[model samples]
Target: MKIDVHGHLSAPESLYAYKANLLAHRGAHGRGSAGVTDDTLRAALTEPNRTFGNQSHLRHLDEAGVDIQLISPRPYQMMHSEQAKLVEWFAEETNDAIARTCRIEPGRFRGIAGMPQSMETTPERWTKELRRCVTDLGFVGAMLNPDPYEGAAQPPALSDRFWYPVWEAVCELDVPVLIHSAGCRPPARESYSLHFIQEETLAVAAMLSSSVLDDFPTLKIIVSHGGGAIPYQRGRFQPGALRAGITFEERMRKLYYDTCLYTRDSIELLLRAVGTDRCLFGTEKPGTGSTRDPRTGRWVDDIHLLIEDIDWLDDGQRKQLFETNARELFRI
Candidate 1:
């Protein structure tokens, strides 16, 4: 069974309506409901107008040769820089909607929660939502935004003691934390897509340089979008300017990577850098990769085909990349 580790919910318009109301009232609405129902979900997913979605999320999964997908809230739209209460309310509702969607199709989908992170709040404070999603909502894992304040200000690095609360909790809970960044609001920031790359590159560099993993040995992290230019530009981190204490590649292997890179060449580089055992299939389908690659007729998010095209990969590597790695990390 091929399990895609990276996916975002194709939520109903009604669920997003809650965001509109919350923003309109500036959280004075007292945490509005998503108003999501199965029928609304069906219409939103299967309908022709998805903003960036296909006719159906399930159909995209099938077309991409994915059996199951672990889905989280759309990271770009999460609005992590909003006020704590407003962010938390929206996050709670999004997780609830994801749970609701997974329940509708237990075999095809699983929930990966989005934490309500805001500027100036302790990371541990949001652990309650992480715990709720895992224990109460029966989620498999969660997406941790290392920079919740976006690009407005410098937040604590992932290796800092400031994040100890979250690290300690994930270690005990035994769930993998996806190292992804939320929206970027810096006046001179690059496009949102490029922002994901910048944050992930910084996260990998910082985590490797510090002893975060040594402090919590059991903690698992999956760096999305193929480690965000780190693997490709390995020479920049070759133990000269930045010291990871250990060899850069060895430290990199300690963390996991996802196959969300848009090109086959980049995915190959990541697999070579981190090895297949430390890699998992992650398409991020219906996100930026929803569009078709002109050279190939299939959508860019059809990562299974991309991996299949890599001639050097053996069957064992293919098996690990497509299924084994995700199964072990998620414990499914």
Candidate 2:
């Protein structure tokens, strides 16, 4: 019953071709279909490639002892900074691809939709697609891009009223959201790797400092990459939180974190900071940390192995980390 919550789908090549055409035409061509077929999808997943992100991913999961993986669109390819129409269409295509993958193996996969978070659109507008993904496509949750403008333009912080519509909808739908960031467009800005951590860290800070959790106490947000440095640097904000008359650590406990941290020490620190109850097993297999570790002779993304080796985690805590917490969070 091991479940990994932070996996991304490798989209079919036809989807990318459609994207290239859409970008090339700049909306003059009007929106076209994502011509991905069953055969092309088979080719995409079954064939060998540089990363096993999608290529034979099921086998990789089996070898790593994962029973299920929640699949979402690759955050970097979400195209959130494009025009509203283009972003909407591409998001549909990307979500459809993820839906198809889950349909191919319902027992082994669940879907987290790619939202159309284009800059000009409000969070309310994104809920249309969010609802469609949940009710119509049978998705369990969605991946939210914190910076849809790709650092070109700063959007409203997650704590602002601008995001209330989406939070309201999330309460109505009962689906959790993953706080992930998309590509970096500015030449001088950090790469998506660094940008991911920066945005996630900011999201944690903003939400904890504000009354978002108090306003929407039922909202479930799982920040990726081990909650983006909060577990390590929480002391920096403790003084400010004390002045404000709230426990900073208590606010942090309200949010969830995924075990995508690569090293044993980092994961241990996350558990200590956020608690085992707040952590879910997640391996971004075939993504970052795919390379074999020079020290351990195992794929760095084999997080279950790392968890199994943690001597301090009691059996119940290990059970919670490897299986129980995800089932409870995803309601799967």
Candidate 3:
């Protein structure tokens, strides 16, 4: 029962419309185009659906030994820079596409909804859309952007009161939120992977340092990208937690991480620092950087083999990391 909890979906029509809107707006502002060129973006957006239900994705799953994938909209499709209304509409279209793909092979896929996290989006709207995704669309969870204020505007941090309403809704709904970053805005943080890592790590640190977990103890968050350097920098944060009279391990235990670190040593470090129970199997497959490993001749995104190669994990622990943890976290 292997499950990949971190996978992305790109609905071509929805994405193309969003890109068109962005380009038009940017041109008006004399900012030209934003992000990828038209041709590249369209190709990447359509590639996932080309073999969505035609056994191509299934064949990749079979070869990679993944039994199920919890598909969410591609990070870029969140469109946090757009107006809140457009963002919500884009989310609906993206989720509909995901539901359609899941219907093609019900047992092979589940859905994680995308949220309209633009600065103007209200908590009521967020809750309504979340309920729609869960009760109506049968989605298991959602992706949350810690900061959605694009460009020069800095939004309130996740620990501030601005996010309390969403936190309340999450606890009431009993669904986990995968903390994911979308689109880099800062000049120094232009690289996608680097910016994502920085944002996710800083968000987690801020959450830990503040009273967010204490305020909503039942809230579940899965920090993507192997907890984003948190495991490696435990020493830097431990002293602060100790001085603040908080249990560092207890706070960390409440959160979960996914296996997208892309290397054997990094995965081992995550397993050691975060433990097996808190780590969920995830692979952002069929996206960028999924090249064949020269040594193994397997796609680098095939992370199941990476876990299998770890010598210390017994069968029970491996089972927990590969399947049980995700099942419990996402309620799948």
Candidate 4:
């Protein structure tokens, strides 16, 4: 039952241009070549040499020795369309695409639907999409970025009351909210390059400090990129919170984190901080060595090292980290 909980899928071929255009636009503005435009993604789509296009990503997962991979559209795309009229449609299409992939091999894959945060600006919109993602699409959960709005400089949407609507919905769905890193506001921007993990670190801090977890006691959250430095800085957050007359260590204890860092030391530190029960396996894939199977454009291989590296873990801890914990959190 070894499982890698964090995995990503490319935009279906029809959506490549939309992504490429975004990257080209950002590149023009000095955002760096990190952004890949639709053309580039499309070329990957059409390239005969490449295997991870759209259809065969799962085969790669098998090669990686992963028994299960939780798949989702890019987290950034959770906010793909800002226009109110397009939010529902965007959510529908995204979930539909995810559902299609999951159907290919029901037990081996699970989908995490992307819900637009902006649409959640209103309570009703949040309710609708959350229901669709959970009930209609059969997705296990939703993926959220650290920031509420894409390209904005602020903490997580958790600080805003508008997001409460979605928070409530998540609790009702009994699904884990997967929070990944994104951009940050000023002062924080400087760390973006040096500590690329900062965005998600700050977001987890905000969630613990804010009253979200307190408000929804049953809500579960999984942080990406090895909990983005939070486990390493757990003590730092509590002392500061106490000094400010706000203590949240107890609530912070409820959070679940992933092991996406590539090194053994990094994984050991997080395991020590959070303990094996609160940790899960993740590879960030594609960015690592996850390419696609030749015929199917889907992910062929995923974050497999997490399991191979488990000889250092206690037998019980290893089982919880790779399989049991994720099953309890995701109900898969």
Top lDDT hit: 2
Per-residue alpha-carbon lDDT of candidate 1 for residues 34-74, written as tens digits (9 for 90 to 100) = 88998877665566545444446777887788899999999
Q: List the lowest-lDDT window of 10 residues for candidate 3.
A: 27-36
Per-residue lDDT for 1-332 in model 3, tens only? 89999988744453566557754574344322223334443344344444343224445667788888988888855768676666676667677777766766688889888877767767667778888888898888888877676434677778888888888888888889898888765554466577678778877787876888999989998989888878888877787778888756656766899998788889999888878999999887655536677888877777888889999999999999889999888778
Candidate RMSDs in order: 1.7, 1.6, 5.2, 7.4
Candidate 3 similarity to native, TM-score:
0.86
Mind giving the per-residue lDDT tens digits that candidate 2 earns over 1-332?
79999998866788988988888898898888998776676666566656754336666688788888998988888789888999999999888888888877788889998889986788889999999999999999989888988888778898898889888987899999989988888673588899999999999988887889899989999999999989899999888878888767877998999999888999999998879999999998768777777777888888999888899999999989988988988899
Error of 4 at 319 (Å): 0.6
Write down the RMSD of candidate 2 (Cα, Å). 1.6
lDDT of 4 by residue, 1-332 (tens): 77778886544555544445444454344322223344544443234334343333444555566788887766545443354434444455556656765665577668887665553355556567768768877889878755544445343355567567667888888888887743333434454323336667776777776777778888888888777777777776777768778554454557888888766677887877777888888875544445554564434333445445657777788889888999899988
Rank by lDDT (best first): 2, 1, 3, 4
lDDT computed for candidate 2: 0.87
lDDT of 3: 0.76
